[model samples]
Target: MADKIFRNGEIVDGSGKARFKADLAVEGDTIVAIGDLKDMQAPEIIDISGKVICPGFIDMHSHTDMSIAYIPEADSLLHQGITTAVTGHCGESPVPVTNHNRSYFRNPDEIKDIDLPWERLETMGGFLGFLEEIGTSLNITPIVGQGAIRSAVVGFSAERPTEDQMEAMQQLVEQAMDEGAIGISTGLIYPPGSYASTEELIEVTKPVGRRGGIYFSHIRDEGDKLIEATKEEIEIGRKTGAAIHHSHFKAAGRDNWEKAEPALRLIDQAVAEGLQMTSDMYPYTAGATGLVALLPEWAQEGGLGDIVKRLSDKATRLKMVASMKTEGFFSIAEWDKVLIAGSSNPAYSGKYISELAETSGKTPYDWIFDALLETRGQIGMILFMMSEENVKMQFNRPYMMVGTDASGMLFEGPFAQGAHPRAMGTFPRFLGKYVRDEKVLPLEEAIHRISGLPAWKLNFKDRGLIRRGYKADLVVFDPATILDKADFINPFQKPVGIDYVLVNGQTVVKFNVHTHARPGVITTH
Candidate 1:
């Protein structure tokens, strides 16, 4: 006897293969069988005719480390058929916090409104325990953030770590792995991860390789220095012997779009040489991050407080302005592409830099600086920098996966205003627009990107596949009708056609509505 059975569905087993007609039976938190179950005895039998049953989607690169602590229901994630989220991407995790570096780490301004109940956790284990105690609607795994570890020991300094500091950082990585962190992540574009050299990264990730954990990175440069950065990332993986996973991989700005192919070639070359490497990307060309990221790396050193002080100094401000004009992948003329995605100032929340500059009788530079000052370095910006052709090209790669690169946000609340639509629309958009509408990728391949592929990256044998005896984390949806409703202007809306979602054999979403079920646990490698 089974707990429940889903019958009369087309099953896509999440292996990038063909679909088959089958019935799946659930017993407790595992799938008991997958075959013809016409006579299977169970307390409940759900008719899933005209729907496709597949393993629940896994967000390979997520930033819900702190957001999950606030909104544990994970309404947006549940609605998108995401049963598991691989959090702590781009070198932002909530644990291993010291009084010295916790406040300045990650995107604090985005979730400033939510009163996080467990912000004081000091270790990776404590952070995971807090989530379990609060109850989450989906499984969440964390990768120990390299930025947090660096900031805690180095305090936003641009200089190389001392021999003692380097050893301490390695110990932190080993400790985090022991405490259940599945891997290590680095936002190389963000400080102090940016401050770290290749040697430092290789040394610190030694434990990850030893423990068979992955090395996830938001590589040093994604535009002009993309190939150079990719080589460095691969070199680190080679030296450390850790599997490499790139986050939100893209070549930013219009001019650098052509570098996408060469970057892919470099990745392929690494793989051909027996280096294990993969990457995850959202479907859209536009990418979002903190507004302060536009500042030259030197200006951002010494943490937010120091940067704030430097922004107010005329000489320092002039140097920053000069750097902004000639230093980045984007020029001053492209300020319009850098729209304000979120801000503490309600008036400037959704406005672009060009519009805000004209309205405020200031130049784009002045507007950007003033906005950053007003928001206390908390403003978020969306950069429409990548080419659509490049986005589709990445999908053709066998190792490519899908990730929102956005944190979990609520439809209405402290975290809703100006949130990127990717939070709600990423998986559905990949399935609906990319796979079904545009025909860029077949449905089977798309399912594998979000499911089995990511699970394989994390070494989770029991999930990410609709196999007998695997964990019963699954989704059932109407392939013809599924589509993302969230858009750039109004991003708080959820998608349609994701009718049923089960996490750990518990139905958390039915008829596109969350049941407020928190069946998630911290799955560690």
Candidate 2:
């Protein structure tokens, strides 16, 4: 006897093997049986004859830490069959917030209409407890953020840490690991994390390596110096035994697009030498981040507050503009490629900088500076600089996995406005466009990359496969009709063709609609 059963479906098993027709039964939260279970009796049975059944997707990289807190239902993620999300990516976890680092936490203005009840979570355990109290629609695998740890110890100063400060940082990493963080992550391009030296990173991550935790990094540079950045990342793994996972691995900017092949070879060579390494990417040419990323590192040195004052000072503003002009960072030549994804000003949302510059009667640089001021450095943009060919090249790699690098957003209210389409449509796009349409890889291979591969990378033994005794997290979808409706303009549209999604045997999504079930839990190594 079982609580539920999915009968007569093509089961992929998340193993990258051939699919087979079978019936699977779920008792409580585990898959009790998976085979010819025609004789199995259950309180509820689903007939999925023309559908494909596979383990629920595990998003290898995400930034849903606060977004999940804002909307625990996680409607967008669940609808796409994403049952487990590896959040706290790009070195921006929400936990371990201290008085010194409170400002580093997500501000109230980010999620405009929604009120986050708990603002100052000072520890990993505390943050997990708060999540449990609120309940979630899908499980979360949190990674301690390098930015949060550094900010907690030394504010946002871009200086070498003293001996005592370095020791404090190591203790923080150990404390977070003890509190159930699966690994540690760093966004080397962002402030705080970017300010950290390579030596400092190796020291802080040594504890993670000792505990067999992974090291996930958004490498320092992705443009002209992409290969150099790859070498730096590989050096971290060579020096430390921690498993390395590159986040949104890419070669941005058209001028540096040729670097993609060599950059990947560096990773492949590391793997050939027996270094534990892998990477993840979204099926898109554009990458999203704050507009401040376009500025020189020196302009963003102190922190956001200091940056605002710098922008206001006439002499400093001239210096910043002069630097940008000289460096050709986001110049008019690339202005059209920069799309305004999100901002406090709705008028600018979804419009290109080139278009906005024309309407404002200003240079692209001045228009961008004014836009940053209007939004107070919170403006988000999608830089469409990567090549489609390069993106497909990365997708063909065996070690590559999938991740949205976007937040869990809803389809209505403030959260719905100006969201990246990846947040709503990544998995579906992978299956529909890349697999079914483009015929890049077989369906089974894509499932393994999204499911078993990510689970294996995290060292989770029980959840990524649909074998007997494993957690009953599964998805059933129409292989012929699966489609990602989200586009650049309508970024909040929910995907279609996913029939059902379950977490811990509880139906979270059915008939392509969310059932509002909150059966998700926290997973730890």
Candidate 3:
């Protein structure tokens, strides 16, 4: 490896330590040394006199599985200094293997949008190889999705895996771990994953503990049933003895915000009783998801096809309307707080359901039923269901990490058309609003939540810290001007003041702009 020296920069090092001045030397992808510039001799050197060099930010949770193929440069994320991301969250991802019913890895129909060219690898090694061939912007490791695997083993039917099917799922997890999946993930609220029983989850995730990987999920609910849902998760953790991490764990709805203590207490008890646990949360008051997720299980029984069929069936739709009138997904009051996130049909993007009802001359409930019937259940919404004070209270905890529950995307492209704003605005929003502006958390603690904490938790041995022998995935920024510019209406704007971002010794972002460099690698567990 040829030596390259980065001379004279202040290093934050991701250790929650105070910044210190240094000259860093890189040999190929890893930082070989860090010291005074006077001691450095390198074949090539770049002077970084007035910048802060830190360990690359690790996106603890991201949804870049399919989107990475669309935008390999990760132009937006790299500019914000994200060097590593854990994709395939929410139990959605494309895998490599193919079985008789459906292929492995590439199982769930969510990935059907992408024409998966490489499906026979059937292992993590091949998936990594395919990503390398496809090109990418940052280091990434995939979590073998239980939902995709379940869809592969037992089709997308909303039912439990039979005993035989259960064994097949067990085999799938073992195979995935052998391949390179670092952990297992599921979004219990999203079917066909929602249909999985706790025992079934325990059986499948037990292998993760056996293989030394973690188990994480978006549990069945984060609302009124959050306490029960949390206990259910802890029960699974207790049974499997797997290290567990909860995803986007904010208290939602009117009365649930007060339940954060008991929820965290459950995790704390699990820890005391000897189950290693951690969790991540986005620092926002609103939560985003599809309208389908808001429907009752019976309403979304089969799949998108069945959903469309039911929505279009006047009789079935009327029955659903009656059921939803009293028993909505989250709660009754939450109805007032729901807002449309991104709609492919710009005629409705960013409009609140209640507001739209007034304009369209219908009750909010009637409008929702009509909209679903009209759009065929394809629309998504962002709900200001989370309590703002609760978001701050949760983020203030030590165990919580940060994640953008969406994909990395460019400002334009039809692919970016109707996605949540989390993808574009998460990391910067944390630094700008929470840490700098609101003074919710100090910068060191915020960086720890975003970078080092996750690195240690994920066991990415060589990439989390900014020190000699570490990977040169680094973020340099002018903290004062660092802020996310993406808003609810136009949520694709790139952030400002992120001066330089390097991934594995290559400069992907310089002067706060993408440099047309693809330095990211397919990271393995």
Candidate 4:
């Protein structure tokens, strides 16, 4: 709780207004004052020397759930100047609920290692206890996942929930919110969540909506069915009366190239109609996900073992491939578009399906299946299927904000050095490539997208802005040189020129590197 004075820095308060010079005073975890040469004495004084001091960035659509438990300091992200993250994205988290939903898929480590405690999570506070027992690098606020809720109520089966089942699911959401959850998230393309119809979501979201919690989604499809899916999301929000967020927003496929404008228009219309809506997008042309994302929804019905069984059986593989072909999942000719991002078997990293297939003299499908076998269906793939123009168009939209869609891992960890470049590359890429060179948006405006907008969407009061009384989660950076060096082939490379990051008024990262200080806490509404 000692006092410190930050002297002579340009403060971009993240209000999307104008930047101004100020001398800020930090005492304990909050910014006590901001003025010119305040008549105050502090024990420590740091001269910023005219750098831009902005609020800490928030990742709205992040998936940094388990990684933070291992490397709690989060050197990679904090060095790039992020202080807050929203995990439990795209469904599923170890939230304390109950035995019915808790008996879903196991983590690869837990499945391969111990007979760990498994049951319904009764409270968010209990889950927070688990996190506190471990630790984290940045403030983490979680969204109650619809997939986890569905699993607790109905398992991964695609059948509609009975009345009692639906009621139980609604009660679970109420309990989670009573403890801490800010909102609810759904990954419709993934599992039990993808199988949920509008009616089911409305019933589940009723408790969430009544609690003033937000409802976020990854929607049913990201490629062909996107426009309708977005509209469907809006409809759900309208029905439930919950603020909506579209996770990892993007436009993909040749046919969907023109969908961005209409899609954005639809969002704007929804906003005009008094529905609150916002979205987060990664700054990349490709999208990353589990390799099984290409499988027909029907093929992935029963879960990991089912998918593995289908992959192992030649007849089932043929049936799956035919379904994929009919659905235009990968278009046989474009098989090279998929590259391995990570695998339990590290030998497959960076190799494309086409390259691996050529080596074995088999089709890309066979190569993917073989790799799936080796990794036990835990392989991650980066699909180079999005149009760059479509991507830029979405980024230029004002409502679009920044999200890493990645974890807070080091160059080496359970997450290997080069997995998804977005992990270390997103914020810097926004600053260096787009803001500075491409003239995509004004620098301050871009900063707002990464910093303030996300905080606003999640209703994080008194954070994500440089103002008196707000938490002093701030970053000082050199605008001219900030950039991300990571690429698809080298995903974990550190970004350059982010000088200092303060999380919750703690200098967790200083002089452009991690202090390896675990100062983060589990944040709640």
TM-score of 1: 0.97
- Tell me each candidate's TM-score: 0.97, 0.97, 0.92, 0.95
lDDT (0 to 1) per candidate? 0.87, 0.87, 0.77, 0.79
**Could you tell me the lDDT of residue 10 within candidate 2?**
97
The residue pairs in collision within model 2 are: none
Q: Write the per-residue lDDT of candidate 1 for residues 1-525, one digit (tens) a residue.
A: 899999989999999899999899999999999999887889989889989999999999888887788788888888999999999888878767775576665446645455665455778888787888889999998899999888878877888889998898889888888988988999998888888888889989999988888999899888888889999999989998899998888988877899999999999998899988999999998888888988988899888788889888879988998888776534523867877887888788777888999999998877877878878887888888889999988899999999989777778876678777898899999999989998988899889989999898888979999998999999999999898999877889989988899999999999977898899988874
For candidate 2, what's the RMSD? 1.6
Error of 4 at 159 (Å): 1.4
Tens digits of per-residue lDDT for model 3, 1-525: 437777788777788888788888888788888878676678887787776677888887888776787577776677667899898787776663456334333435345566655553455567667778877879887888887778778766877778998998888888877867888888887777778989889999989888778888788878777889998888887788678999888777777788887898888788788787889988778778886666777787666667778766778867876777555464534556777776546687778787899999987766776787676566888888777788777877787888888777777776666656667777888888888998988888788888888988888878788867778898877677788887766777888878778899887888867887777876764
Regions more than 4 Å wrong, model 1: 103-120, 329-333
lDDT of 4 by residue, 1-525 (tens): 338888888888888888888898888889988888657778888888768889998888777765565566776677678899888888765564555544345545435543333332345667666667666668888778888888877877888899998898898888788878888899898887888998898888888788788888788767777889999999889998889988888767767777777888888898889888988888898888888778888888867777778888999889888888866356422667888887877777898888888988988778877778777777788887677776678877778888888877777655454467888888888888888878788878887998888888877788988888999898888788889998998877888877788887888877766776666777775
Q: What range of 10 consecutive residues in model 4 has the weakest lDDT sum?
A: 113-122
The local distance difference test score of model 2 is 0.87
> How many pairs in model 3 have backbone atoms within 3 A of each other, for residues 3 or more apart or on separate chains, i.e. clashes?
4
List the RMSD of every prediction in angstroms.
1.7, 1.6, 2.8, 2.2
